[model samples]
Target: MKLILKNIGLLKQAEITLYPLCVIAGENDNGKSTVGKIVFCIIKAINRYKEDLQESKEYQVNEILQEIYFKFRRALPTDDGQIPDVLRQLRAITTGPANLPEQLATVREALEQLEQSGTETRSTRQDIMDALEQIQLITDQPEDTRQSIENAFNKVFASEFDASLLLQGAKTGTIRLYDGDFLLIHLEVNAASGATLKGDVDPINIKDVTFIDSPLILNHHDLLIRSQSMLDVDRKPGRSLGRSYTTLHTKDLFDKLKEPALPNDLFATRNKALLGNIQKLIAGEISYDKSSRDFVFTKNAKSISIKNTASGIKVFGLLQILLANEVISKNTMLILDEPENHLHPKWQLHLARILVELIKEGIYVLVSSHSPYMIEALKRYADRADLKDTSRFYLAENRTIEDRNRLGEIFDVLTEPFETFRQMDAEDLRDE
Candidate 1:
């Protein structure tokens, strides 16, 4: 899938055709992280809409049309109290109009009155006009109108309300996700009102999408607190603290750990090598202690609590556990925001290798980072004959003009910091 973003947050415009292994590199405050967050929110929104569609009961075309008409009527003026009467007549006409000509005349007169009422009536007039068009269509092309009403309802109701909240200082923005030449989803956001207008070529199912944010290293204390709170349903809060990728990932991991451990044989075969690589890097085996309600790391004949582990270890430990439990598999779309955080240069290189292994296993990986070492490692791994075709790199800059058309060539952007250091060194040697 290719994600096209315009006027979203710090990203004035960007078009990313996601590869199996994708890297986004940029300096600080250049919207690299924002790109990951936006993609995550879009996927989550599509999943939420699909869930709502499943839960909602079916509605008849006439019923939906009537409901829309009533909603508009309520917003219309009631100065002489004649609006209600007019709405009632309109409602009667919707249900098998006995005299189409008479009913149409009544609707026209009402619309004319609304038009004369000025600005307040503008939206109401449009609503009536839309209803009239649908009503006329129903008389001739009943099926076509039915489909139209269904499409309208889907567009309006399928909107992701919380997506607007993720966007900051976004006066206006558009997100488009396409599958090949066909558009799967299109979202438009209004920053002032936090309203989203959504359109989809077809329904989206995101059951296999996974998003990880910048704080890839999970805090042991926070995880323990959240775990304890989950035990007491009455004390557990309903509101989210902050919907960062880490928070969601932690919650999901906790939930999975709470479930009975899957049989050893049920583990996914594809993650075996990845999990082994993580264990080798950390030099420890991670296991959940159900009795103590904590993660235990066993290494060199000693057992230690995960809370006492290094920050980098904890990050890999999280992935290790998820892989062990079969939560991540070949079909997963893994999105990692700043995976280089809390890891040393050596570990960053190891992470790059693990990501290469994942890509080889058919897992789609998206990474956003500002670290030169991380990007260099990725570049090295991407140069392999097998990965060359599946890897892509993007440079996100804060400049007015964005070069999104360029793909797979970001060597200059990745080595920018080193070039600055080299220039400084050359000047210092010349002065000496």
Candidate 2:
């Protein structure tokens, strides 16, 4: 897969081709996360198009049902504590969203039955039946890709689309994704008209993609409790769309973590081994302690709150939980940003190995980092596994290049501090 981004966030233009596993190396504020976010918005919009439509339809239908029920009470109420038999029959509306029309048909029948029972006047009965006809049960058709992408962008970014997102002095911008020569997605944005997209979007091979920018998400994991999916919280009726400092990506990760751990027969042997290694690295298990309502790390029969563990533990613990929950699968793409942030050099290498191993199993991973140790480890491990052919590396500058031969340039950018320290020598240390 290849991506082309222009005038989005801090990036003026970047064309990066992704492999089964692509590690992007760049300095801070150079748009590493920006590229990742654009891709996330595109892929998620395509993969989740149908599911989101369902959620919206469900929400709408529930609203209409509520209105009809309210009118029913006002129109006809038995003298005693009874919920008239016809009303009671309509009470059990246990139909799925996909069969929404059928559910409405059932409600219509209840209204017709009420009319026959003579519980209310013809005038009152006609008013209730009129509501059923007026109900707008059909979901908006996404005949084009622009609608889907904009919805995803709105929810994921938690803000309205505007010119402020464009690069300075730029009138227009675009983000495009392609499969070699085939254009899968094209998004054009400008200060004047906002954003528009065009693509053949359905449930593609990637049904979902999770972007883990930091492990600190475990700190405020409970903000959105029992969220079934992104739409569950995002589509809420009257909530402010402008989320000042957070994105839905973090909440999505928490939902993935909370999902019931996939049962056996799911990559039973391969993933089981990976999970074991992760736990061993942390020297414990991290799980939600229901009794305490907190995340706790357990080691040697002793447990402590996750807040008390090393930041590195939080990193590996997340991997362990995602693996145990069976959320890491070939179909799910992962965009990991600066995973080496809090890891020791040794563990960074181990993390590299684990990432390479994931690609070997057909899972796609995109990692952005500034750690030479992490980059070198990934390169070497890719070689050792004989999977180097499946991996690609990119340098995230304003302009783009494959950047393999110019590895030194990237390393220089990342390792300049090391060079500075070595040049300082004993005299500089004594002076300090």
Candidate 3:
């Protein structure tokens, strides 16, 4: 699956081959999430695709097309040579705009009027001309304008996911790969005017290509979304906090792990697998308390959940939930941003191992990390596989004005994987 992006968000251009269990590692504020958004857009395009994108919203198309039109109009509008620009402009103006359903309805009505009038009228151009004249925009006349808008509506803005929709502190998201393979989990939220806007998404497109299923849009983005402030909530189980901010007790996990569990329990079947993995990861015997709901570990005696628990643990739990619930499946691409949060060096290494397993199982994962520990973990994993120049690793840094084309760093952690890991980790420590 090859995916192409033009002037979409922060990415000017990117061409990446999709691999199962691919990881995207970059610094903050380098358009990590934007890549996800483009993927989501592509999935939506596939969903609403038709012989003519007449069913597509106008304003959405306009956002992209309008930019080009204004640019070309400034450069050379009269140039019939600018038909591509005109087509691009048409593509932009045809997609429905945000908070402008009335405009879409108006455009739909005008098209209907033109179609109805064409039966009685000798020329279809006359009806089109009449419609555009009423559209409050200057154009080359009815037929040209109507056809232009219609043409714009038909072109698809192919994409798979938006990272910002899934990860926090991610803005100016970008598209990474050109792979058209994606899954669209659309979440819509009610608007102030009793309308709805896309809210959340789940995409499985990464650097190494893997196609899972036919693209489908799940209209539940509304329920899964939340603001960054919600992350500040205490993880303790309580009615006063957001669902994503909370943690599960060991006893609760154990009970849920039991077979024939409630359908509503998110981690029921996966909990047992998750527990075994955790124990194996630390090379320890683990026990849980039914009273305090804490986990006790032997060999690493200090690993009592009370003082040893961290955000990394919670993040692992969340990932486990996602896997257990089949949110991410076999032969799917997973784009993960900042997976090293609150994890110790040991756990980071363990995560690297887990990621390697996922890759071997044919699941693609893309991850961006600020932790040198994570970078080192990846180094070790690459070493174990005897991978020369780990081409999967990427880093983002301040690009010189002269090197604008090089917005991020794509490095093959050859013999210097460990050294590269140390340098990056040191840089992060200095920033902190």
Candidate 4:
């Protein structure tokens, strides 16, 4: 899927085309995380209400059921339609396979009897409630009132990150990027009392924030990422005492890249292969224990752990967790910004390989990057004779998007090497 952003955060206007193996490469403070957050937000919004991250079986079930309910509600006729729908849904839940018409007829008869007897429909209401209790679908209560369910959903869907540092969107002139999906991962800023907070400092139109589909939005306290913040202590409880930062729980992402695992069934309930491939791409690994509240990098492997890894690896791990179950679905659009940051050249190439694999498998990948290493990798892959034609690149600099067609023109202009290749005889080429 493509992601277009306008008037959001540091992005005055930016667009990134996601390839199966896309990369976002630019200088530091260029809003790479902003892009990722936009994409994450989209994912969050789509599966927002689920009691699981985008990757859980229960979350998927509820999502599917929600769609089914929406369709069912839409299909009802006019007049006594809503009442019939309620009855039919209740009936279908309690008594399997009852038609809407049949359920409506029963409900109407009960109402008529109550009206004729000049009595309240208390008994009839009890009957409806009993039927609802029997239904195998979702619970009979309103969804918003279910705190336990909402909390569970929030935990499951929240991205694994110090989301609180995400700042509020600045008011800027509107600029439209690609028409792709955008995910809102986090929103937070510091306050006047020296407290970093979640949400915008000033009220802004919530409608101003829009993604083509529902996107996931996370929140964090501003100091969550800073070393001196109390949030840090909360994040690593054992670390509150004197502890060596080097001994903190961390993992070798490179090693994980070499030996991938099938996603936990909870995460990859649908497409195991796709999840496997993604695990291979980023070298998926996570660290978690009963004592800890969240997963850390596996290499560090300590509750009071503190160690350093590149921002790229941290971001990749976060993405892997967010996207663990996404690959199995056809409708998902993966939007990323500057995935090449903090990655070594070899890892960049490895990421490229994974992106190409996903594209070939029919997944839409959208990315924004300024890294020449990443660009060269894609060009190398795209230039190969056997590569599929699904590859395309966009340049987002100088406040305007330059398509690959323009680059192709530039390549044509710069092509004196064609003559050199042609002039070199097969014997010379082979000898070299």
Displacement of the residue 166 alpha carbon in candidate 1, Å: 7.0
TM-score of each: 0.64, 0.85, 0.40, 0.39
- lDDT value, residue 432 of candidate 4: 89
TM-score of 2: 0.85
The most accurate candidate by TM-score is 2
lDDT of 4 by residue, 245-271 (tens): 210011111212212332333254454
Candidate 4: residue 299 lDDT (0-100): 35
Residue-level lDDT of model 2, residues 194-271, one tens digit each, is 666555432346767888888776766555453333344567655445433345576667777656543222235458
Worst 10 residues of 3 by lDDT: 212-221
CA lDDT of each candidate? 0.61, 0.70, 0.40, 0.41
- Model 4 weakest 10-residue run by lDDT: 212-221
lDDT (Cα, tens digit) per residue for candidate 3, span 117-165: 3432434444344444444342222333333222321222211221223
Clashing pairs in 2: none
Off by over 4 Å in 2: 81-102, 116-119, 134-150, 157-165, 199-204, 224-234, 239-245, 261-270, 290-292, 398-405, 426-432
Error of 4 at 171 (Å): 7.3
- Sorted on lDDT, best first, the list reads 2, 1, 4, 3
Q: Is candidate 3 or candidate 4 better by TM-score?
A: 3
